[model samples]
Target: MHGGILGCASAAEAAGLWVMPFAGVHVWLTPTGHERAHDDCACVVHWSEALAFRRNRAVMTVPLALEQMAYCLGKEAFFVALESALHQHKISAEEISSLRALLPHGFDELFRLATVSAESGLESIMRYRLSLHGITVRGQISIPTVGRVDFVIDGWLIVEADGKGNHEGPEQRHRDHLRDAHAAALGYDTLRFDYALIMYDWPSVEAAILGRLRARAGRVVAG
Candidate 1:
């Protein structure tokens, strides 16, 4: 067996700091003769200098794990995990700054976009996607009688990205309806998207949001 530390998405997932779907294990072995003996199978191998700071013996340090994540998980998944780590206090802003030098060139902006306010991977993804369209989203906004919402767009639009686990059951459904009703009474438009809709049918979600924005824009102009 190869004596190596689990890195990248594998390490991130194990730390409970990653929620995105990934395939295969990623192991980081230093460039040593015994470490690089045979060709690998499904497990991804990274030949790099493993950092000394590690919480778990079997896994690499958070910074090193995140560096490997940037290389293997692409921008979106990496950003999601980074935010999750930040939210959980597993990683710090200083640690994230250290990673800027190690990541690919185009990924610098992702470090800037990373925020601890993102409650879940689904919220992180939705915010990132909307940012692509030049939409500025404010997250974790509190409103009287309705409590806190996920993302608020254009000051009047409440966009809730509900994950599979949190928003289930009849009681939760009833609460959600009451929140939406309260928001409506306060002249706010609520657009709620579930995991399936956000992940699979994004076009329809985008269309609905865009349509609402346009209508809101027209109302403002007319008044």
Candidate 2:
């Protein structure tokens, strides 16, 4: 009995986190409910007589919340939330392993794509979307003097995924350009894309990345 209408709103609002709502609220139950839920509130009534799960906690348990997410939103989005949780230190590796074992439906594929450094859901989106095209991208890897970046593809291309909030300041912008220069000097090509560009203009984004990959391949062939 947590999350959804239970308690996530104030905290998510306070932390400036975005939560995607389904048709209804989510809850684990052992055959109990106090009042009638609202018309819009959809609930997941998992019948579990397990005393621990039925505890009157404030928010839903992290494992249960993550389980609800995986069940409702599909594995791709679940990994996004999972990785973001890991990055925020909200959950630990050992706990995640235990949780994964508890999750029904095989999760080898989902965990296979997980990483601890996806700073935002959008970064997870970037990496997962690219992966569907057989592109392998690693996140938050640091170079010698160019500092750390969001995603790197083919071990030679550096991609920086920018949400609207982070890249606004002139100083940050200047530092990004300097890092790009330094990465280029180290023989890596860099591409920076904003949240809107990646989310809204996905076809264009796909085209741009595929083109860059093809060009790199061509260069290698010529060499």
Candidate 3:
């Protein structure tokens, strides 16, 4: 009973009074010369709908033998899209493995790093390399009258990567300074590199230590 100007256009096309939007489109027509758009498009029909209707009709009529492959697949429907998203975000290997372990059913072939323990000296070397240039470098250098120094490269460098429950309190600091002074007297340098430096800012820590080492080296070379 209700028909607007656009509705009349649709109705006229549907009722064979005029051509439908496409060759094979069968739009609904009422006997009273009215056309009814699909309920989904009742409120508004975009101009592009005509083009889409024609294209859809063309697609539906084509034989499997005649249709060519489509050029672009939707990203949401592609596995590579997911992989690209992961890589773009720099998802870590450990995180991927953890996710796979937690969600046992879904994903496959998670990334993982090789499992191996780093040696003590190797770890030290790694730190040393990270230190800035002109820092000291002393390997297995001792505290003279106390304990064996792990490393003392720069003249005042006293690097110690301590584990839990070691080197705590004023007494320890005093003793460390005393040892440091003794080493200084012996023309030694002291600078400490700790777990924090190793874990975070490792590069900057290495740069700093290297700087001190380079400066010490320069002094020795200059002398």
Please report the candidate that would top TM-score against the real structure.
1
| lDDT tens digits by residue: candidate 2, 1-223 | 3422332222222333334334444444444545445556555444343223545543455455566566556766567667667667776777687777766656666677877788777888887778777678888998999988888888999988888788988998999899999999999999999988877887887878888888778732111
Taking all chains together, each candidate's TM-score versus the true structure is: 0.86, 0.75, 0.36
Separate clash counts for every candidate: 0, 2, 43
What is the Cα-based lDDT of residue 52 in candidate 2? 30
Worst 10 residues of 1 by lDDT: 50-59
Q: lDDT of all the models against the reference?
A: 0.80, 0.67, 0.38
Instruction: Looking at model 2, report the run of 10 residues with the lowest lDDT sum.
Output: 4-13
State the lDDT of candidate 1 residue by residue for 56-142, as single tens digits. Answer: 333477777777777777888888888888888998777777778666779988877878998888888887787777788999999
Poorly placed runs, candidate 3 (over 4 Å):
1-138, 154-158, 219-223
The full ranking of all candidates by TM-score, starting with the best, is: 1, 2, 3
Instruction: Please tell me which model should have the higher lDDT, number 1 or number 3.
Output: 1
**Pairs of residues at least 3 apart in sequence or in different chains that clash in candidate 1:** none
